[model samples]
Target: MFKLRGRLEKHGEIFEIGQSVKSPILAVLPSLATKFYSNVPTPYEIVDAQEDRKTYQGTIDNVNRQVSEGKQGRIFAVVHVAGKQFKITEGDVFVIEGYWPPDAGDRISLDKVLLVGASDFTLIGRPLVQKGLVRVEATVIEKTLSHTKTHFRKKRRKQYMRINFYRIPQTMLRVNRIEIVGEVNHPPDVTGLETRIF
Candidate 1:
């Protein structure tokens, strides 16, 4: 059996794009950035990485840190969506409102992964996704909820009140390794898709 991309719901439904969607679908939300840069530096390398294991580990750690700083993430972010603060889990989809900063706006892809354990092997982004991989796409389902109220007061007369509400909805995405391209800079083409990730 295939493992779930994120979390499963009590009565949720899974819809895979190709073949048949056998997995469950939940609300999909993008991650937020803790900090940002006006110009995110391109992927780079650290010198003398293989001089020592400790040094190599340190270099890896530093690279990961840089990636985190450049990309948007849920870590250390105090999101106040819809007048409420919430921490997003790995599989959660949060609909954030308000003006998205230009640098922070747009589809910010995340590769600073915490942990990715597939059923077969636990490979890092060295070999991103395998060929014939599954592609997942989710739409903004809705916005978070908000409340509105009206009240009337009068001397000796009874008071009247009314209220309205709204909530943010979201679509969930669960994509698999449709095609493992073996490199991040060069993603392979997914079958049926017009273009591949560049």
Candidate 2:
């Protein structure tokens, strides 16, 4: 007699009495085997710390050389603007929804950079990149209202109906340029309001 176990109890298997054999259920369902016997460690090769550091330093030096030579090529950046994040490149035009303070023709620098990329490499920031490292300049080209939207409500039996129309303000921005202004991994000094007196 063969005693089925767990979920396989419904799907019975035939075997000779007192015969010892591996579970056919595990053989049929490899995934279940992994769930039940998942303690096996995956194999990975280890590298020397000095060698790894040398490789990392070489990559940084290559990026720095490219930046210094002005050959990093067309750059792109993910910048935070008006509580929204936009992936922008030079000469790109994008819209910002809702009220913004910058007037048309006003030039501004987007400081909260989440990432910067070029043809060769990419730099990802933890919330934000180092200050003055990547500069993203843009111009407010126009400000206008979005298309009108209608909101309607109705109630059956009571015979109540309401209608409303609205439009949201939008700001248009044109990215002027994106460049690496400071060395990689180097941050500028933070001087907090030294010229102001309380």
Candidate 3:
């Protein structure tokens, strides 16, 4: 057993050392920021956020105008799928290279949204946007194999030669639509408060 030179002093020193160790680890892990800072914007984030401390709702009048006018053809979202990201809009068709999980003709909801942009505003996620906030509904149009690719290798001054053929499975998706359901700052009520407004 070690002798304590006053319990408070020893505990305080240990606590300080523990905090010093955790500070570095916390800094390295971005996921811990929300717990430590309540998701407060960093200096770099503040600068990136239009160099203003205020949220992207730059003007109340502008928001009102956009609300009144309604969202049009400018709606689009950056969706993450099968280790790749694609910037997609409604009615746009894009092919997902390599093996994909969904079946052909299956309607799947893309929840890993990196960013959602409109004509007036942009909502960017830290790593991924919150699920259900920006809904990206897509349909698996077709699942097929890519064009035949031949891998050829030859050694100079040697008789070693090898050829390999591959046809990667590809998934074609049609973005059904992107719907920004609610405000970023506030979550819509269960009773359908958003429906009441324009």
Candidate 4:
């Protein structure tokens, strides 16, 4: 019907009225539904998931390749996790605020690498580096609540007072390692630059 056509157009879709396809409302609706989904935009979760899927079968494979070539050592990277950015190194233990889903003892890989580095080189991601290029592994060590904070308010001579306390859930993570599976630029060789001795 004409009403259906207008609604589809509002959603930025267009349809042509076929001359020979004389079908009832029931049969045409199914086909229209299919077309609607195809034209509509997908949720960001689906989009990021499809793009972030790791293609590398094994991080060890790339590590072996790096070892064979003797390219670099002591890799570090900035990764995004739990709605926050963290600069992490191997064997680092850090706490992330808020409740995270993964249970303790669960190992997880974070691929939202903003930048990866080594003693010799750096690879900067436009927003996020390509999937399977840099892998950051971590283990959920503990999940616990933070120390309760007290909020107290009082007005002199008014006899008004209020008090509240709260503890935020937090997750503890240990950075297992960061592996670079692709080529990167080497950092400048300035031993004095590290300590600002210039």
Task: Please provide, for model 4 over 84-145, each residue's C-alpha lDDT reduced to its tens digit, 9 standing for 90 to 100.
Answer: 99999999988989878899999998878998877755667889765566779999999999
lDDT string, candidate 2, 1-198, tens digits: 233343332235433334443666543443564567778799999999999999999999999999999999999999999899999999999999998999999999898999999999999999888777899999999999999999999999888999999999999999999999989976656655545899
lDDT string for model 3 (40-108, tens) is 556653256554535445653455456446743468899888888999999999999987789998999
Candidate 1 residue spans exceeding 4 A from truth: 1-50, 53-90, 99-138, 149-198
Q: Residue-pair clashes per candidate, as listed?
A: 31, 0, 0, 5
Model 1: per-residue Cα lDDT over 88-188, one tens digit each: 33445655454333232233333333223223223243333333221222234343333443454445545655444544333222221121213322345
Best by TM-score: 2
Cα lDDT for residue 124, candidate 3: 82
Candidate 3: deviation at residue 52, Å? Answer: 6.9
Error of 3 at 112 (Å): 0.5
Task: Assess the local accuracy of residue 105 in candidate 2 as a C-alpha lDDT between 0 and 100.
Answer: 98
Which residue ranges in model 4 land beyond 4 Å of their true spot? Answer: 1-68, 155-157, 183-198
Number of clashing pairs, model 4? Answer: 5
CA error at residue 125 for candidate 3, angstroms: 1.1
Candidate 3 ranges with C-alpha deviation above 4 Å: 1-69, 187-198
Model 2, which residues run further than 4 Å from truth?
1-40, 189-198
Q: Cα lDDT of all candidates, in order?
A: 0.35, 0.85, 0.73, 0.72
